[model samples]
Target: MDVRVTDDADVAGAADETRSLLAWLTQEDELRGRVTPQERPPVPGTLGPVLDGLVVALGSGGAVTGLTTAVVAWIRSRHSDVTVKATRSDGASLEISTKLVGPMTPQELRAFVTDSSRLLEGGQGGQGGPGPDGGAL
Candidate 1:
């Protein structure tokens, strides 16, 4: 999964917050070395390589579910309006915005996590259920 954080409210804060999210993800017991930032070549006059998004390797044993939960937790802890989008290798993606999720209750938050995990896992909200918000992931 490749995770990207976008913050239209503060361009400068996006990178900082993205790094913070990366740090938080890496700290998870199920993630550790499984997370790495995406590297891009610098433009003509840039000083160093560009770092954007994150490539997280999720395998068996509920790692994907754990990742979704951690991501929601990170978004809930943020003070800025940032949206995190995670794309799977198969091109399926899920976007979670801090602004949208901020007002959700604990149960709603858990459902959000569960729905995200299901969508990302190609289950589309688990069982024969509908996708979260009736939208494609």
Candidate 2:
């Protein structure tokens, strides 16, 4: 998932919104819950190097403010089997990038959440590419 925090001026608010969003996601049957950060090699390491993903923006109240172009780039690099893009809301003037990573199951979403959690706990966020076996996914 590519999440962006457009309003950096209010980092605390953004975090709050992130927490609320995560909570809401957990309650939803469709979305995979919160991202569980995993422990992997750091971004500087060679084995399973961490990839620089999109930056999610949090509003003053911790709500998702907006997304950026980086989100689109990250989605494209991570999920090659799918197509991703973003659009702006004319009324709200909010820019959001949506990436289609095929389809995400509840279980997969949970796994992603776990992986995200691990990343937050200092683990490598996303894999740069394929491994020795040429496994990208």
Candidate 3:
């Protein structure tokens, strides 16, 4: 899957901030051996200029839940004024956009990511309890 994160800070600093966030995200343990950086192009359906963004290619077996949770938490911690749009795509696609204004603890972020991941994987029944690999939330 490919994950893209765009930093929507002011135009003057958006590019640099996005680059820095991308570099930091690449070093995360959850992304280790899985994420590769890519250039940002103009969004396919928009007329806007090339966005100040970063792209990460995730290995097929990478842990999406862990990686997404960490990335969102890190971005929120560093850039409260910036809006972030994180998009994950394989055959199916998921996109989450947010600007961190109110308080969101790390635990809450993890739970949110876990639930989102489960839903993405088509496990929305809410009764299975565990994932396909026999892992509980």
- How do the candidates rank by TM-score, highest first? 1, 3, 2
The lDDT values for all models are 0.69, 0.30, 0.56
Candidate 1, residue 78: Cα displacement in angstroms equals 1.0
Give the count of colliding residue pairs in each prediction: 0, 25, 0
Better of 2 and 3 by TM-score: 3
TM-score for model 3?
Answer: 0.60
- In terms of TM-score, the best-performing candidate is 1
Model 2 lDDT, residue 116, Cα = 34
The C-alpha TM-scores of every prediction are 0.82, 0.25, 0.60
> Model 2, 1-137: lDDT tens per residue?
33422312133353333343334333433323322222325546345633222233222221221122223233333322322211122111222122322244545434443433333222343423212232223
Candidate 1, poorest ten consecutive residues by summed lDDT = 125-134
lDDT digits (tens) for residues 48-111 of candidate 1: 7656668888876678888888888888888767777777766566777776678877776777
- Local lDDT at 115 for model 3: 61
Sorted by lDDT, highest first, which candidate order results? 1, 3, 2
**Least accurate stretch of 10 residues (summed lDDT) in model 3?**
125-134
TM-score of 1: 0.82
Q: Whose lDDT is higher: candidate 2's or candidate 3's?
A: 3
lDDT of 3 at 47: 65
